[model samples]
Target: MTSPLSHLATHEVTNQPPAPGDRDLWAGDIVLRQAIARHGGQPGALEPYARALGTAAMQEAARDANRHPPELHLFDRAGRRLDEVRFHPAWHGFMQLSAEAGYAALPWEEAPGGHVTHAAMVYLASQVEPGHCCPLTMSYAATPALRTTPALAPWLEKLQVRAWDPAIAPMTGKRAITLGMAMTEKQGGSDLRANATTATRDGDAYRLRGHKWFCSAPMSDGFLTLAQAPEGLTCFLVPRWLDHGRNPILIQRLKDKLGNRSNASAEIEYDNTLAYRVGDEGAGVRTILSMVHHTRLDTALAPAGLMRAALSEAHHWASHRSAFQKQLIDQPLMRAVLADLALDWEAALKLGLKVARNFDGTADEHRTFARIAVALAKYHNNKRAPLVIYEAMEALGGMGYVEDTPLPMLYREAPLNGIWEGSGNVICLDILRTLAKEPLAGEMLNAELQSVTGTDRRFDAALKAHRTRWPGLPPEAEARWFAESLALLLQGALLIRHSSDAVADAFVATRLARGSGRIAGAISGCDTGAILARIAPVE
Candidate 1:
């Protein structure tokens, strides 16, 4: 009984992009706004760029960058050794925008709560496109290490520049510059101490001769690499170009990665490459430690932003599409799922920024708390981002699985953050190390939790249990479990203080009191509608 025109009508599509923004992506996020306000930032100032990032043009740039991944040109015409990486224009556009936004060196500028402000901006920008943020993160991280090396004092001006100068040239000629890192070798993955790259003494500098298996942001103007010097493992600043010509950093190849397609990671061989040693020759690990901590914070924050992006997409789709003659969002189970995702997102924001705020504090206690808490936050939040994003994707059914939508991209990006900087086992072991070596960290954590001693009976009981049994640390076999417990306890405490009654109640009931597994939507009947409404973007 159907007419021929019925087929044409059925071809219409529903549920898609063009999500709303507050002239800035930062202001639209209630949790982000709360965190920013608490940290003394005027969200309105970031609105313009945030709105630009959400535009069709910027979103297209993200897709185009990934669609056309960076390609390597190992040789130029006439068989000259070129060793360059060619990227799409969209990649440069993304880089330039972020660079101008001051994501790389805002905290170093000594702004009020600058680290928190930087973290929030990074979180917002990452939701738009994460791959381009890689080099930006490295530049931001490298500032600490660079500050310690007096020999490189003049080059410090280049790092502080806010412009995006992507020209592949000598740092001496460039007005602005970005930094990269090459630490891992074939034999050493996370264990930088085992690096086999050797740096021999040269006149006023050193000559590096070895291979780096993972050289992040190979196109960067400079890199912070590790090599074995006469004393021990050392850190060196290897410029892309030297006085004579381009450094002899032979680009073995660009890694064919699963995700982060917009950015380039390379494997390179250093053939007597010139480099300037930073810090004491044997104190490489100590010198790069601060850099590592900064990157880890961004690593944890990226996934949280990725989760928010996925949730936004899913929520937008649900709000528009109808099934069984009812809007998708109106369904009870979907409500529970979205609400649960929102709860996790809020927890991630609260915890991530809490650690960042500690970075800006001048007190010794704040530094101690950050030392232990950063590891805890990075481990749990990064590990959970993928699962959370996948669940949010599931809320979309078949459409979420398709490549045309952003879900596929978000899904692919989920594991990158957790794997980078440090993987799950590595981060957990770091937490255990902190517990064994740093007593002040534990004391600060305990004191922080005790502030809300009677907020929730469940949280109080869990804290008591943790204090009593935490002295005898768990063995390596159960380090993950121990770390997860610490992270959950910290999140619960932060929520009790920062979050509203509804969010706090839901988090404590599911994460602490019940002690349930990792299933999304496990917490039910706890103002699911309220949380979902707060997080869902208003169009």
Candidate 2:
């Protein structure tokens, strides 16, 4: 009864799930929906972009863009210096889609709950293509740093445009602009103060001369960099395109990175690169920290999306594929693993969104909470993401190890966010510093942890035990443990308050009560059916 089209086929394609067709990222994610409303964001703003991102065409686009990474073109046929990095059309298609959807411009556009909306979009788009997210994330983060320089007002205005303008023209002629950053040098990976790039005052602007170890989004219209000014370390805005011609900024080479292959990162030289100074000279770190802070939020939010994508893929495979003459999902052990992974996924989303919500808070406590909670979420979420993804990948057995599935991409991407902005130790130390320096941060964290108190005896006991163990702050050696513990409490508390009893109980029971073994699915007393239902019920 097979169609004539299949007559030449080796065999019928059965048991394989239909290729994940068009998925409404927003519509399908009930947890994301609840988080949006709970955190003061309107859902409609995310739907259009979500729908577009979920299309089969978009899926192909994401796939093609990564499969064919960006190519670096340093010169034209005439031997003229080009210093341009060209991408596959599919990459540009994603940039255009994100640009038009206001991914970078959303928070600054005066939309209600802009940060929350932006955070959700980060979560959604990351599930589709995370590589393209770097430049947009930098663009979104650049607003505050740009605002400090009145002379750069025009540059700031250009960023607010709700379009993706990828042209070689000056900002004056461009409808929109995306910015990049080049801060770290060979001597200074995370220490901006160690920068040796020199900047000399030239009329109203400055001329920079040096090389950077890393220049994120090398093809971006302009770059925010740090250079050694006469005063001290200073932040400079280096434009790639000028009114007359290209600036002296030269691309040395694009980084052969481990992942995020779709995005172009580079090493470059500023041979007297024309630049405008941002913030006061010597306050470069302070000014650029604003951008870093915002970028950190995306780092936290992106891992959640990665985990979800991996989980979805594994869930689909399990549902369709059979083992031992029974469906994989029907096996109690498989269900436990998927359900356990779901707990981490859900916890990350809730914690990240909670931190995103605080971003919209204008009050003092809100700011304090945002600063510290972002680090906690970023630290722990990133740490757990790789493991969660690896477990999900394992569920697919051998197929998971191959690039034919999304598991490899998801796994590679899982570690990048952790390295960017700040690594694990950097974030942990930052947490300790914040607790020591900012009294309100500690107070707000305590208030958050206590809010869900008495709801569960185990949670209450864990909280009490945590406070007793730390007393104030643990030693530097215990920084990771301290940070992880606090982040877990916050995640557990949020899950209890916002999630279903099944989710709340699984989290507290396995995580808080230590009812589970070290690895995922190593637990007892879990309602696997109820928890797995959150992922997708097995028919």
Instruction: Report the number of the highest-TM-score candidate.
Output: 2
lDDT of 2 by residue, 1-539 (tens): 23334334587666666567777787778898889989988677898889899887898888899999999999999999998998999999999988888888889887679899999989988898999999999999999999999989999988977788787888888989999999989987987788999999999999999999999998888999999999999999999889998998888888998889899999999998899999999999999999999999999999999999898889889988998999998998999999999999999999999998888888999889999999999999999999999999999999899987888988989999999999999999999999999999999999989999989999999999999999999999999999999999999999999999999998999999999999999987888888777766122
Task: Estimate, for each residue in 1-539, the C-alpha lDDT of model 1 and write its tens digit.
Answer: 33233235458444443333322465467888888888775465466657778776787778899999999999988999999999999999988888887888677887788788778777888788899999999999998898888889767788988889988789998988999999999997999999999999998899999999999999999999999999999999999987679999999989998889899999999999999998889999998888999998898788888988899888988888888888889988788888888888889888999988898888989888888888888898888888889998899898799876778888899899888988999999998898789888878887888898887999998877876776677989889988998898999999999888888988998888874446897666588877886786747
Give TM per candidate: 0.96, 0.98
lDDT of each candidate versus the true structure:
0.85, 0.91
What would you estimate as the lDDT of candidate 1? Answer: 0.85
Candidate of highest lDDT: 2
Error of 2 at 427 (Å): 0.5
lDDT of 2: 0.91
The reply for model 1, stretches above 4 Å from the true place, is 1-24, 42-45, 515-517
- RMSD to the hidden true structure, all candidates: 3.2, 1.8
What is residue 146's positional error in candidate 1, in angstroms? 1.0
TM-score, model 2 to reference: 0.98
The clash count for each model shown is 2, 0
